[model samples]
Target: MSRTLVIGDIHGGLKALHQILERAEVTTNDKLVFLGDYIDGWSDSPRVIDFLIELDKTHDCFFIRGNHEEMVLRWLTAGDDNAEWRIHGGQSTVDAYQDLDIHTKDRHVGFLARLNDYYIDEQNRLYVHAGFTNQKGVYYEFFRGMFCWDRTLWETAMSLNPALSKDDLFYPKRLTLYKEIFIGHTPVTRISETVPVNKANVWNVDTGAAFKGRLSIMDVDTKAFWQSDPLHELYANEKGRN
Candidate 1:
């Protein structure tokens, strides 16, 4: 059956992205949801965006806005060049666009601007670039900012006692709100292996393609995953925004 595949951060690692897609055997029948941070780390930020644009034209694809995309959009539309974004890998994206024509550059900006903060499928599976803060006594929409920057959500899930039943009164309601929550941003390598990590129904698929790991893609329902080789090997000689 065609599956709904959710991919994690690309971070400008075009080679890894292509490899993971091929490894997953993605077909036009599948629905692909990207968890964002598409630009920044590797040497082909512009190329990555271009590939995504074309992929969207040919398949069912959803793109979520990541902090890096937010920073770059701010720079493109509002002229706000935040240092934090630059230090975190935005420089590679900027450098990649230096030679592009205004039309192509604007297309990139338009694509980035249209990214969603989070996407919830009919099955109540939530897909977000980062995690959302379930502010006590408030609706989730009010804390949308958390969807793109919250580390606490993942950290809290990681800290939870694994033995608790889903119905345990003590189980976090925030985590139970959705059947499953898939996120990127915080790389899985920090917690365990260089693969997708699951904790408290939250699956983190960002295997750190921007840093030292590979890019990842997972079937939303089956939890089956695929990854590229370590990004270092993919782009053997490049520094890759390090």
Candidate 2:
């Protein structure tokens, strides 16, 4: 069967990325949906983008934008930098591109620029780097940043009353916008989960590749998944999110 796999935040762990893809036995017939944060938190930020650019050439890929990717674009496009970004792993991404030629940098710029804020499939399944806040839906969201930074949507889902049905009048309207929602950005490692998390109809695939956790990918239909070894171990000698 042609599986649709939703991947979590990569956080520049190119080795883990490759290992996870292999473990999952990804085929060109499958649809790969990346939840973003392709860079930062590791030494292979530039190479990760390079590999992804090539991967898209042979397979169907959907790249969603994450908060870190947003910062990457800002730095590459307009030289925007802040202490927060640096301390949070942006510095690794910035340093990764330091020696690149303008032509190569421009190509990376195009790649990151073309990333989607959110993606919805024909099955009414939503894929995003972060959660959306608009009760109506993603299209009606006012702050574009919310697409890659909001946590309330996931928080709301987690706090949802299991006894309450979607038909209830008090159910969160935002959660009702899609049949199912998938997000990253906020790592689930913080909650002590190393696997994909499911709450209500929302699935969080970000198992925290940016930190000491593993990189994960899940089949949207089967909920079956494969994860790489702890990213910190993959790049033990280097410094990044690990």
* Top candidate, metric lDDT: 2
Model 2, which residues run further than 4 Å from truth?
Answer: none
lDDT of every model, 2 decimals: 0.86, 0.92
Considering summed lDDT, which 10 consecutive residues are worst modelled in model 1? 132-141
Worst 10 residues of 2 by lDDT: 233-242
Best by TM-score: 2
lDDT of 2 by residue, 1-242 (tens): 79999999998999999999999999999999999899989989999999999999999999999998899899999999998898889888878888999998999999999999999999999999888888899999999999999999999999999899999999999988899999998889888899999999999999988889999999999999999999889999876764
3-83: candidate 1 lDDT, tens digit per residue? 999999998988888898999999999999999899888888889999999999999999999888888888878888867
- Candidate 1: what lDDT? 0.86
Candidate 2 TM-score over all chains jointly: 0.98
Q: What is candidate 2's local distance difference test score?
A: 0.92
What are the root-mean-square deviations of the candidates from the true structure over C-alphas?
1.8, 0.9
